[model samples]
Target: MQKCGLTEKSPGQYVDTIATDAYVWYEENWQHDEYDHSHQRYQLTYVEEGYQYFHIEKKIYLVPQNHVIWIPTGKEHRTTSEAKTVNLMLVLFKSVSELEFYQNVHVFSAPAVLKEMLRYASKWNKVLTEDTEQQIFLQAIQNSLPHFCKESSGLQIPVPTDSRLIPICSYINANYQYHFDSDVLADKAKMSIRSLQRIFKQETGITLQKYMQLIRILKSIELIDTQQFTLSEIAFKVGYQSLPAFTSSYYAIMKTKPKLKR
Candidate 1:
């Protein structure tokens, strides 16, 4: 396993100097299947090409392209790639006073300026020899952190821990393009419709119907960006029976109308 961040000389030891502890790098085809772990420094990850999923606690967050995911120090989390080739720019640094506001896991849109800065920093993964040059480099990243912290709505789904719901979720992920009837899902879970509904809501914090819609919307985003299908065709392919309903649902979840990239 190739870790990109700087390894501390001593465990659990807080260092005061920001110049020595900070690390930055860019990676391609990055995939990690490690168990949940935490570090002493905060991690800022920007997805430049493909999508990635982060498993934190009981929730799963989907981070798409041109977005950022922030992990605070000592927060246990793990990441998995959603695409075959995922590109990313990552930074690991000590929590400074200016960055204290980002103490929780945050997923947001990355501005162009921050993206460029990260790209520039990734070019030199080693510490600079000159004191003045190192100070200039570190200060540039520090100044841009506040600007990149703007919050935008991102997709996050609650993962149910109940054993019975495991297969149900897997089936939905594999066949979200087909209509999912509540009764069928209830039968699969070996529970009555009402009992299944109550347990699903209690465990995942969302209704079964809403969960299916969210899955469809996520799949629609990928299809809209990759395939040459028309919006109506894409809607039908993602299990939406009516174009208006699909458009309305897309707007509600993505906060924008679905459009193909020219």
Candidate 2:
């Protein structure tokens, strides 16, 4: 292993100077609400245990355990982990060969191989010298990232920024577990239902109904992660009156059935 050269520089300064290829770290019992910031390096954050909510631009992604969030270089974002105990493996690459996958932010399912590679890479948590084994190994991980990242988890919610739509969105987010008609949202926004639907689609790129469904599904993922509720209970908790309705909507978003974390 290459010896770590610890420096007194700030986090940004250290990453900018020391990371020639990749900088890696494994954080246990990690919980933080980070400020909005951008990085020069492409970042991969793997959630080994708890979950994190990543706000990238207008979208909020729920990155649950056994999953990874990839943020391209210079993407403005912030992350909040409300879970009391979390394990995260974070890797920042100066650059990678896969430009397509590195162009946008995505959440992908982390396979066992990738997780094991991350565990091995965690040991080399500092700046790596060129031509060293550590650098080569880290490079391999960077190369494999794009391949494994193709399977997206589809756990994101797009938010609207329009002032007229803000309250409606807040209402839906807060009451995602209850069924409400579009009229309620229209009343909240002080707009006609037709106008509300149009502006919501224009700003969020999805219909108001779809957005509400997305919120419900997002909340369901959180509830599922807790391992405290049965699927039926979670379905009802997230506003679905029946299990089949919940399963159908969940499949539409996640492309898979909800897995109980037993």
Q: Quick one: best lDDT, which candidate?
A: 2
Per-residue CA lDDT of candidate 1, range 77-123, in tens?
87866465678887776645545556778787788887777777766
Candidate 2 per-residue C-alpha lDDT over 9-96 given as tens digits, one digit per residue, 9 for 90 to 100: 4432323556467778677887543867665778888898878899889888888788998889888777886665688888877778
Give model 1's TM-score versus the native structure. 0.78
The per-model lDDT (C-alpha) reads 0.76, 0.79
- For model 2, the run of ten residues with the poorest summed lDDT: 1-10
Q: Which residue runs of candidate 1 sit more than 4 Å off their true CA positions?
A: 7-19, 33-35, 98-100, 123-154, 224-231, 242-244
Evaluated at residue 196, the lDDT of candidate 2 is 92
The candidate 1 region of ten consecutive residues with least summed lDDT is 8-17
TM-score of 2: 0.86
The best candidate by TM-score is 2
Q: Could you estimate the TM-score for every candidate?
A: 0.78, 0.86
